[model samples]
Target: MAYKFEVYTDKAGEFRFRFRASNGEEMFGSQGYKQKASAMSAIESIKAHAPGATIEDQTK
Candidate 1:
């Protein structure tokens, strides 16, 4: 796959997710969630909203 979401527990034992590319480089990560369901919901929200997201390009 060109990209994917990975869920895992941190050293602190919190649930978190990271978005990665095919080359296994991380693109971004989510804040830790108390429950796995909350983390999954966050992923779904991103999937539903990302397609319509605009690039603000604040660096310009």
Candidate 2:
């Protein structure tokens, strides 16, 4: 896959997720969630919504 989502436990023992690029660089890291299911849900949400997501360029 050119892109992937990784789920991991942070130092504080919270479940976190990171989206990585094909080069293995992290594009973004999600906030810590107390439950793994929440983290998974977040990933799923991204998958479901990101395709049609729009860009709001605040720098304009």
Candidate 3:
């Protein structure tokens, strides 16, 4: 199966999304959003624009 991705309201009330490889390794990229729609959009965009890329590293 593809890496499992997830989105939810963070404690800061912002929308948070993340995904990890099968080995429990996160993808690489600094990504996040303040809105749910943006985060969702990012998920699609990332898949399209950065194929095979992972958010293994990001900044808060």
Candidate 4:
């Protein structure tokens, strides 16, 4: 797959997730969650919402 979501445990022993591109560069990362299921739920939420997401440029 060109894009993927990776779930991992950080050094602090907290569960987290990262979104990577095809070249293995991290596009973004999520805040640490105490539960792995919470991390997975975050991923699912992104999948469900990101497709219809809009870009709001607040830098104006």
Clashing pairs in 1: none
User: Could you arrange the candidates by lDDT from highest to lowest?
Assistant: 2, 4, 1, 3
Per-residue C-alpha lDDT of model 3 across residues 1-60, encoded as one tens digit per residue: 568677777767888777878876877532557778998897788778886766776675
lDDT of 4 by residue, 1-60 (tens): 599999999999999999999999999999999999999999999999999999999999
Ranking the candidates on TM-score from highest down gives 4, 2, 1, 3
**Which portions of model 2 miss their true places by more than 4 Å?**
none
| Shift of residue 54 alpha carbon in model 1, Å | 0.8
**Best of the two (1, 3) by TM-score:** 1
Please write out the lDDT profile of model 2 over residues 1-60, one tens digit for every residue. Answer: 589999999999999999999999999999999999999999999999999999999998
- Position 12, candidate 1: lDDT: 82
User: lDDT (CA) for every model shown?
Assistant: 0.95, 0.97, 0.74, 0.96
Candidate 3, residue 9: lDDT? 78
Please state the error at residue 51 of candidate 4 in Å. 0.6
Q: Estimate each model's TM-score.
A: 0.88, 0.94, 0.63, 0.94
Taking all chains together, the TM-score of candidate 2 against the true structure is 0.94
Model 1 TM-score is 0.88
Give residue 28's error in model 4 in angstroms: 0.2
Q: How many backbone clashes does candidate 4 have?
A: 0
Between 2 and 3, whose TM-score is larger? 2
